[model samples]
Target: MLELIAIFAAAASGDVDQVKSVQQRDEDIVVTGQRTEGSDDYGVSEQRTATRLPLSQKETPQSVSVVTRAQIQDFQLNSVNEVLATVPGVSVLAAETDRFYYSARGFEITTFQIDGIGQPFAFGIQTGSLDTSFFDRIEVVRGAPGLLSFTGNPSAVVNYVRKRPYREFHTTASAQYGSFNNLRLDSDVSVPLTADGSVRARAVGSVLDTDSHLDRYHLTRWTGYGIVEADLGPNTIVSAGYGHQDHDTDNAQWGAVPLLYGDGTRFDFARNSNTGQPWSGWGVIDRQIFGDLTHQFGNGWSAKVSVLRRAIDEDNELFYVYGNPSRTAPEGINAATGEGVFSYPGKFVGPTRNLTIDAYVNGKVSLGGRSHDVMFGIQRGAERYRQDAAYDFGQIGVAIPLSQLFAGTFPRPPFRRSTACTSSTAPRGGCPCTV
Candidate 1:
């Protein structure tokens, strides 16, 4: 058995060298653009042209960055946010383990596209984090893309190219673990469906679990995706795909307040300051579903459409205080007690829907010894969001054990009368506790 295993390993190494030699030869073989089908040179020329179109990075008019699959693999990135952070002029602000805030060139980016089709945006609702495992490539166009993307902020646009089935068969699996007890597993497979090799399919999926730096906080996620492609007769192709993801988090806080000293200087708080306490944590759940369809015409033209829907639910509890230091205490009140204190607890549930459809035709034609590229397209999209928040102070008990009221223990009172939560309808000319 040992001798047989050694022989097999040597044969595999020899095959690797042969494969490298063939690739080197292919790279050296070049042909003219006008080659007939099945001429052995047509496929090679087409692939070379596609590779060089975007190679002259400095010559492109727009600021663009391409994140290749190799780069993603090198960085061990499982999410789009992780991959985008390596690019210049981009930032990712994580609202929570399952939610993220993306900004570029000092402005918030609201628009995202898949294979050049728009992804709708919803305000005040979480757009679940994007999975990087299913993408073949990511293209970022910086600054205003009004001419490229129909409507959006001038910051930038992100285009995700999904993995498609090729003539070959391949499969890959990976697992990773990191700080904060993070763990993830991802698998992907692509193969041909029929002997004719005209029809193909690909599937990808992932599961993740992690604990946040925040006390008593953790998150879990699952995703699945599948795509199918068919060649319907000559000079025509069709493709369709669907994807779904679910994210859940527990004991998370919306955010923490900035610390200030006597001179207004800020300080960073300890990550685990509020451990194992009631009313000090929150939870949120988010889910998303999306689909796409595309068709190609023989005459250098194609059209594509994509749609996505997302839903988010959140629950939160916060504490604040209000009152004058010199004011007299009310009946049954202890003067030794710390300054006035207040508490506000609240819940918010939101459902968001988005639909975007677009069609475009592009072609390259020679006119008077020069090639002119032309593109014409139209797009329409609608985004709607509904939020239901249950706001009331009576449900939350009165402030007691000031240390318990405030997630962090401080010398100042937990309650204070300030414009932050003050309302004009208060009976005593002071702000009442409102969530």
Candidate 2:
């Protein structure tokens, strides 16, 4: 055994000397390198969502989950809801076809951030679906980060990080087709705008047109995003971007189906049955313009300031039906015999706008012969929301048969004057909300 070991060591030393001689002779040698920036990976080495200080998942005090670009692409998670549904300890609750609510740790998640900045929602909910085309990664903190997120929600805080311009020119695109007539296309491009590669730009967009399995239901959505980043100096960077999303859904359900008859008998309905009229739809538009400035000091201290302006508008034409039908067999609740079903049809439009600013300074200091991280931040936000609704009390009180509702035989009721005040005409002080 000792002789074999000696022979192996001599062979290894001889190979090392031979390689050194080749290098000294200036022989042609190929050098290769890899670029990790903007590359696809399932996990990241560090994250700052938990406390705004860089820490790995294992180092964070609270539970943290990072859905990286590679995971999203592999799972085909196009919507924010789809992405969160895959996370552990997080549940996505669907209120309807497009509306969703999220919960974690048995508590509802109400705090959502974009690049670590939170914004107020118009109706206390995300109005439309947020696409994942422009996002690089999603960080989920399965607990409260009270320092940054004002709301001390014990559930979780979700932060969406946008994709930045890569120093090298790169592009990617994909097309997908699936069941239910779903077709989707997306494109992402990054390019260097300056000779030194210090100035860069990126753009991402996606389009989706799909028909659901439910009868008379369909959806159309598209999103666009563009950003430009420039290095003002060696340690300073400034970036600005704009993003927009448009969502249109047809034949959206407003209420659930009745599972029991008035006589307390179970009723079986078709899985594909739709209770909404053909004209019923909900359209939403979302837009945002954001900019940020970051500077690094030689003393290991860094400062960042960010500003964002967001606008959201939605138009709703909906019909809600609810009632237990009689056990009259074939014609339980038809047009002629409207015994138990009732309908509420209305038109509504809501518009919301907000402006938010965030600034923070973070650094490490030596305390008691040990390094400790410290961060100080301030956030300011202002928002305005207004809704206008058209209603007719008579139509709301009328009874409509369930059979006729599904058959699309009933006609739409005439809309009367809007009872809710609009933002443009309302006084600055306030207006009466009749909705």
Candidate 3:
């Protein structure tokens, strides 16, 4: 036994020229040539909305623009409306104080999505009012949306790509202040839950409080998003998340003042002029729960299914004014005294609920002698909006001098419970409200 041990020891002592590295140290690996993939570049994108076939931005048969994260940061775009205003040919119309509508190519953009799954457009909605803090990028496609939506619209389609969690820990924060008491703050953090990074979690949140250029107008908004991702296997993943938005506005408006007075006199008003009452505004709250599952076959074919359940609650108090009035309805407007009679004073309360789900499969296929990307997909959605009807508090007699809004004092009218409207089709839910 002693002789055998001696011989083994001598053999284990290898020659000076023979050596092996059993483990690699940190210093041994250096990434000197590493570069960021999607750094701040203003140009076309590599991927776009899929339509049963894979296509690039340049190859897609429509105009496409990718609002990258870098551009969003550079311009400090806090909301989707602000981001879309930067797009050429798109118009952001301020329908009210926090209620904005987006129009492009002669049509209102009513379709919205997150990660390629459609989100319901609320009734009497002000599109693009969503907080953009949780999005990694926004892709806008102009013209007919085709199969991308359940019932496609003629205008543009916007897809908000959410930030994905990687097998790394990263965190970032930002704050900004602007005119009219504008203040916004945002933060995002991501971390791996497992040592191998097969599971991960990310959280993003923001707060915005500001006073508008309009007199007596104020807005407050708070938003939060949280997500968890699990890598089921080498070719499968599952993700779930929840997002919330709570917004409130004071002194909201329903319409702009008439352009012409009773005497057919055109008054040039200041751009910032507002006719909103101090007690009128909106209180809106929205929440969503979303989940996604994706699986990839070894042959490069992948399938994905995504679903979202959304609920919205809104409280609206409105005082709206309309066009000029004739002698038949003499109280419409009095040009001589700058007396304007608004349509109605009411409280509209409603809740909106929606559910949407979509599934798709895509892969590369050989046709003739060329390789082409092909995909097959199907989507379905349903929504129901219920309201308790608006309380027609009756119109008020106010004096708003054209181009001189600050000089006037507006009063909140009392709720009129008696239904004495002359219209035969008066909406009895609250009272007949018509212009």
Best by lDDT: 2
- Candidate 1 weakest lDDT stretch, 10 residues: 42-51
Q: Who wins the TM-score comparison?
A: 2
Candidate 3 lands at a TM-score of 0.80
**Of the pair 2 and 3, which is ahead by lDDT?**
2
True lDDT of residue 291, candidate 3: 95
lDDT of 3 at 239: 91
lDDT of 1 by residue, 1-435 (tens): 654555567568887665555555544522112212113220122111111132244555667777777777777777788888887898887653334767888887776776666765444113345678777767777887666665567788887777777656878899999999999999998899988657889899999898866666666778888888777654445667777666655554443332432233443346564322334333445444555554545344454455555454443333333321212444212347543343444444445455666665656678999976666667776665444444453534344343443354322223222222211233221122222
Residue pairs with colliding backbones in model 1 are 321-415, 321-416, 322-415, 322-416, 322-417, 323-417, 341-415
Predicted candidate 3: what Cα RMSD to the true structure? 8.9
TM-score of model 1 vs. true structure: 0.69
Ten-residue stretch with the least lDDT total in model 2: 27-36
Question: 180-282, model 2: which lDDT tens digit per residue?
Answer: 9999999999999998778999999999999887888888999999999988887788999999999998887765767788777887788787777777777
* Better candidate by lDDT, 1 or 2: 2
lDDT of each: 0.56, 0.79, 0.70
The segments of candidate 3 whose C-alpha lies over 4 angstroms from its true place after superposition are: 1-38, 43-45, 50-54, 122-124, 323-339, 392-435
